[model samples]
Target: MVEAARILFGEHGFHGTGMAQIADASGIRVGQIYRDFESKEDIIAAMVAADLSDFLDEAVLAQAIAMGDRQRVRRWVLDLMIRKQQPNDSTLLPEILAEASRNPRVAAIMREGDQRIRRHVAAALAMLAPHAESACARCVEELMMTLMMGGCSRRMALVEGDWQFLEGCMARFLDQQIAWLADHDDGAAAADHADA
Candidate 1:
């Protein structure tokens, strides 16, 4: 039912989609769908949750980021920049974001999803920089993530958008950030060696 709603919602937007239509798409009876879900809001929340579950597992990415693997981080960012262009799994993101403006529940779900990514960014900062807690690091990370999301939004707007442009932008951004991180790591290593 949720999958059917995702497709319908993507096609028709939230307001245009109806429970009966979702039932028809899923081949499930409306009565059963009502029994399964509390309300339309509940169904919407569940759909967002299920989508976010596969979106990004921060636990795994955080592990990779902490290990100072630049390629790992780059690959993840590259994947993100191009995700909307992929043939399968057409996202209902624009519709979701539209609903989020007026729907507190949807807004909260979106916030939770963005928060997870932000936490990973913060964690990576902590791992790579001696001054991760400083204002400068916070500012740079915020700028980077905001731009990354903008690139994602742009990609979704086009039928065959240029993923390579975003990828290149991210590559340069990562190179600059990673160089700073490496410098911090090197300084910390030198300090440890001197102490030894």
Candidate 2:
């Protein structure tokens, strides 16, 4: 049923697709879907959750862990914004966002997912900039993430190659972050003072 739903959902936006089409594609009796899922919305939510779980867990987080502090934070965010574009990865969240523009329920779900990703970004930044609290680090991380996201999309629209402009932007952004940290690195300052 889900396989059918995936195809139908992918082909048409969530609101445009119907359960009958899903049943037809699945070659299962339409009622069987009900036995498995309560409603179309339920199936949509389930499909979205299932599709996102693997990319978010494996490709995204694993990539972040392998990266350095600034790269980890940038990649952590880039992963969220582009995880859908990954080959063989589902674009469910983007679809959900589109659906949410008209659907309060879907909008709420996407908002919740957005919040989770924001927290994950905050955590990644905290790992990179441990001298700063989560709140402080997240402010910077969110700004960079938003910049990368908007920049990548615009760059992709104008460019034809697989561009990894993130590293250069991150380096520049990190330089700024480092300068700020140098001036306010209480931990390092305290250690220096203690050593003195």
Candidate 3:
């Protein structure tokens, strides 16, 4: 049902899609669909949760951290920042965002997902810069999030080649920031040791 809704929502805006359309696409009965999902907002929430699970994959980050592999963690962070959007996602996300603006429940769901993302980004940043101020890490987190969302929006608006060029530029920018954070943290540690 969720997959069906994702397709429908991508083709048509959130308001344009109906339960019957989802049921038809999924080959499920409308009654069963309603029984499973309280409302369209619930379905959207589920979609957001699923995407978050796939995107964050916290186990990967946790394992890297546990292994004390700074380079591995750095690579994971860069991968997260520059993930490519699926063709479906390119359209579906904008529809979700448009609905979120009008529906408080949808907006709340999006907010919760955003918070989860922020926490994950913060953890990655901490690995890069253990001594960095929380405020500084947060600034970087916001910048990364903005770049990600802007990339999605650009994909939705532009042709493939146009966005790919901008994407490469953003990826390079994120790579540089990650490298600087790691270097800065190493420098700070050296200074502290020298003082000791």
Task: Indicate the TM-score of model 3.
Answer: 0.85
Candidate RMSDs in order: 4.7, 5.0, 3.4
Q: Model 3: residues >4 Å from true position, as ranges?
A: 159-172, 175-196
Best by lDDT: 3
TM-score of 2: 0.67
* Native-to-model Cα distance after best TM-score fit, residue 96 in candidate 1, in Å: 1.3
Report residue 123 deviation for candidate 3 (angstroms).
0.3
- Output the lDDT of residue 184, model 1: 50
Q: How does each model score on lDDT?
A: 0.69, 0.62, 0.82
Model 1 Cα lDDT, one tens digit per residue, 31-134: 99999987677788887677555655555566677687756766665554344433323457777788899999878878887886677666655555544325
RMSD of 2: 5.0
Which of the two candidates, 1 or 3, achieves a greater lDDT against the reference?
Answer: 3
Provide TM-scores for the models: 0.76, 0.67, 0.85
Looking at model 1, the pairs that clash are: none
